[model samples]
Target chain A: MKEYLKRIYAMLIYLFLYAPILILIVFSFNASKSRGVWSGFTLHWYSELLKDRQILSALYNTILIAVLSALIATLIGTAAAIGIHNMKKLKKKVIMNLTYLPVVSPDIVTGLSLMILFVFVKLQLGFLSLLLAHITFNIPYVILSVLPKLKQLDKHLYEAALDLGATPLEAYRKVILPEIMPGVVTGMLLAFTLSLDDFVISFFTTGSGVSTLSITVYSMARRGINPKINAISTILFVTVLLLLIIVNIRMSGNHNKKER
Target chain B: MKSKWLSFPYLVWMLIFIFIPLLLVLYFSLTIRTPDGLVFSFDNFRRFFEPIYLKVFLRSVYLALISTVICLALGYPMAMILAGNNFKRKNVMVFLFVVPMWMNFLLRTYAWMTLLERQGLLNTFLTFLGLPPLNLLYTQEAVVLGMVYNFLPFMVLPIYSVLRKIDRQLIEAAADLGADQMTIFRRVIFPLSLPGVMSGITMVFMPAVTTFVISRLLGGGQFTLIGNLIEQQFLFVGDWHFGSAISMVMMVIILLSMGVLSRYDKEHEGGGLW
Candidate 1:
């Protein structure tokens, strides 16, 4: 009875976690305009999404910001991680806390601060500023994700590479890079995910002409909850779930191999 | 020589990007915007203590506190199970928990809108079961639900990390001594996991205190949190000074909580993020 109860509890929590998302997925295919009942399954909304210029443009904007922000964040974050890793005399704990500020700082603070910064500098509030703000937060995510790997790496591999007639650049390229590639990949993926999903900072920094998918979704949903929004949300939910599954499979496979 | 110059670029970036902007916010928080563009005054800080703004601040704290408790209630058992179970399905469970974090939070809250709105799925399902339709959206309840859903994984992940590191023999010894399951959990598991609980509470509470979008979108903008008030000051009212003050107040609350948690961790766990 105890075991049965525990199983039931687990199943119940799982259902609770997933039921809303699954409902959204199912209704995204409803044929009727009303969200009241289960209509016949149809691909109409998906097709409509393909032709909706504003939605497409917002998606385009999100992609643009995610790509640019992730790239910039990856570079800066990798450098910070390497620098912190090399600082043997410094207090590791204090540096870790400082590195965490960007991640843990309230988005409202980050957004407001960036907005005020751009205003003071007279920089135009648009894609570029959004890109800068996104990168700012994204850098810390990368740094934290990559730091553990850097800490675990063998220092003598680089030393050996240099001892074996390799230049500094070549030693780093041939030895250090491969050792840290897993963390780097994970960091880049995390940065990309964060940049794609961020709304508060984008809302504050986005100018008149550019807006992200999240902001567009917010405005549309706020005006009135509609089925079209469901359509977009369903697509987002499925895409994220699938991407995560693939990433996990790859990560777990690597982890299992290392354990063996 | 060139390597020495490399530090200059990073230092310049930090000063220009982070430090200067934060100092400006600090300055603005201590000033008032007048006809002369700006004046050094404490009016903005003083104004935050007014009843209406203070109520908003309290409401935000209350909401965050409630959400943190809920996340803990839901997250702890799950974390314990994940840490203790060497089952094949553990990866799948972990994947389920973390995958939701990848979806945009706004989109997830909007999904709640579909579920909770009048004439929406929940009400429709209710009517189908020979029951009356229930309107649940646009309430504090809905806002808290949105927050828990968004932050549960944050709570779970850290707790699980800490739980996984705990020595299994301790639990076995407790069981071998004939301690009941509940007692073992309370005496063994709970105390050991307090670090994660503190981290999780900090994680859930900080974001919950300042969350504007979920409350605005899911709570119908009726229940204003500190974050919503801050956003309103900047966007709708065009009062940057007031907004900066609210932002600073939030920063202080978060820093105080973090400081307390870190000090506690130092005394207890020898200091770690978990």
Candidate 2:
């Protein structure tokens, strides 16, 4: 009886988590415009989604920013993690705390503070500003991810490579890079997802004429009752689901190799 | 390995982007512009202490606290069940918890809006069962529901990670000592899971306190939390001084609470951005 109750409770929690999402996916296929009522099923909304110019542009912007920012952040953050890993204790602590500022601070403060800095410096608030903000927030996650792998690396291997007559750059490329590749890749993927999912920061940083999908969704939802958002959301949901599955499989595969 | 110069670019980036921007917020919070020049003053912060804004601040804290408590109550048991030996397919269950979080958060919250609306799905279902309709949407309860729905995973994942790491020997030893199930749980399990619980509360409470989106969509536009107030000042009212002051105040509150929570999370397990 107790075990049965536990199962039921777990099922209810799962229901609470998933019911809204299931409703969304179902309603996207409804032929009627209203969300409350279910009409006959149709693919009209999905067809309409392809032709919605504003949403398509927003989707393009979201992907463009996610890829660029994640790549740049991974490069800089990997290098920084190595450098910081080798630093004096006090300096490393200071730098790490500074790195944690954006991570720990509330999203509104980070977003608003960045907005203030841009206005103060007279920088234009569009793609450049949005990209900069994404990169800034993303670097910390990449650093955190890469730093752990750096610690786990065998310290003597690089010296062994250098002593074997390899140059410093060659030693780093041959010995160090491959060792930390998992961490670097994980960081990059994390940065990508964060950039893609970010709403609050993007909402504050972007100016007129530029918006990510989250911003577009927020505006549409506010304006009330748009089935187009449902269609777009369904697409985004599936895309993210597939991406996460890929990431999960890759991560677990790495763990299995490590265990072996 | 000792080539610290590789970090030079990142350090410069941090100084320009992270450090200076925070300092600018501090500067704006403290200063007022005179006709001649900017002068340091406490007027912005003083204005924030006014009753109207104070009420908003308190309300934000109150609602966030309630939501965090609700998440803890719901998440702790679920985490325990998932971590229990009897549960199979735990990985799949954990993945299910995460998949919703991966979906666009705005859309997830918007989904709630549709369901809780007066003539929406929940009400329609209730009517079909010959039950009275609930006026749930656009209320404080709806806002709290949205917050719990969004942040419950933050509570669950951390606690589950901690529970999974608990040593089987310890529990068995407690049982061998003739402790009852309740005693073993109270004396052994709960204490060990406190670190995860601490981090979970910090994670959930911080976002819930600072969220304008959930409150805006579900609490209706008439409701104003601290986040909504700060947003209004910056976006619509164009009042940077007051907005920065509010932001500064929120930063202090969050930092101080985190400092307190970090005491319980000494090992710093599950501190990653997941």
Candidate 3:
């Protein structure tokens, strides 16, 4: 009886979490615009969703920013993690705190301050600023994930590679890079997800002409409910679900390999 | 060694992006642009102390606190269950908990809008059941619901992780002693889980307090939380000094609370952003 009750409890929580999203997904296929009444199924909203120029551009912007920021943040963060791993105690602590500042602070402050800095420097607040903001927030996560892997690495592994007559760059590329590859990959994937989901920071940093899918959705949502958002969000949801599954599979595979 | 040169580039990037930008915000908050020249003053913060803005500040904190409490109440039991020794399919259950989080945050919150609309599913179900429909949307309850719904995962994930890490031996040993299940849980389990609970509170509270979107969407623009006030200062009024001042105040509130929380978090587990 106790076990049955536990199962029921878990089920109710899951129901609460998933029911709204499932409803929205179901509505995306509804032929009629009515939200409460489920009309006959049709793919009209998804079809309409594709032809919408503004949403398409926003989608393009979201993907472009997410991809570019993830790549750049991974590169910088991995290098910085290695360097920090070799640092003395005090210096490491200071750098870590500096790293945590952005991570810990509220998004509004980060967003607002970045806006002020961009305007002060006369940098345009469009795609470039948006990309910069994403990269800025992303690097800390990448650094954090990468640092743990660096700690696990055999500290002498690089020296061994060098003593074997490989140059420093070659040693780093062949030895250090592979060892931390899992962390780097996780960080990159996380960065991509965060950039994809980010709205508040993007809302402030992005200017009039260029907007992300989030910003577009916000404007549409503000005006009231639109079925088009449902269509776009469904596609986004599926994409993210697939990504998470791929990452999960890959990580578990790596774990099994490590066990072996 | 020489590899430390690699961090040089990142340090430079951090200085430009993190340090300077925050410094600029501080500068804006402290200074007023007069006709003659920019002058430093506390006028913005002074104005913030007025009752109208104070009410917004207090409301933001009060609502965020309520939401955090609700998340804790709901999430704690779920975490305990998932972390329990007899729990099977733990990994899958945890994964299921995370799956909704992978959905877009905006869409997740917006999902509630569909359910809470006057002509939406909740009312439809109510009518079908021969019950009175609720005017659910555009209310304080809706905003609090949105916060709890969105941030529930943040609370659960941290607490679940911490509970998972608690050694089973400790509980077994407590049982071997004179402790009952309730005693083992209260004396052994709960204390060990404080770190997770602390981090959970911070994670949920910070976001809930700062959120402008949830309040704006669910409150139907009727409620002006601190976030809305700050956004309006920048968006419409173009009042940077006042906006930046409010932002600074928000940061201090968060920082002070975090300091207090971390002081108690001796293990320092799961507090930092992952």
Q: Encode model 2's per-residue lDDT on A190-216: one tens digit a residue.
A: 899899989999999999689999999
Q: Which residues of candidate 2, in runs, are more than 4 Å off? A: B267-274
Per-residue accuracy of model 1 over A158-256 as CA lDDT, tens digit each:
778878999977876788878787878778887887787788989998887788888888889889776777788887777666766665676677678
What shift in Å separates residue B223 of candidate 3 from its native position after superposition? 1.5
For A1-260, candidate 3 gives per-residue lDDT tens digits of 98888778888899989998999999989888878998799999988978999999999999999999999999999999989988999999999999999999998889989999999999999999999999999999999989988888887888899899999999999988998899899999989988998998999999968999999999999988989989988998998998898778878887888799
Q: What is the C-alpha lDDT of each candidate?
A: 0.82, 0.91, 0.91
lDDT of 2 by residue, B175-232 (tens): 9999999999999999889988998999999999999999998988877999999999
Order the candidates by TM-score, highest first: 3, 2, 1
How far does residue A166 in candidate 3 sit from its true spot (Å)?
1.6
Each candidate's DockQ: 0.52, 0.78, 0.78
- Kindly give the stretch of ten consecutive residues in candidate 3 chain B with the minimal lDDT sum: B265-274
Lowest lDDT 10-mer window, candidate 2 chain A? A223-232
Better of 1 and 3 by lDDT: 3
Q: Tell me how many clashing residue pairs each candidate has.
A: 0, 0, 0
What's model 2's lDDT at A50?
A: 80
Q: Is the docking of candidate 1 incorrect, acceptable, medium or high quality?
A: medium
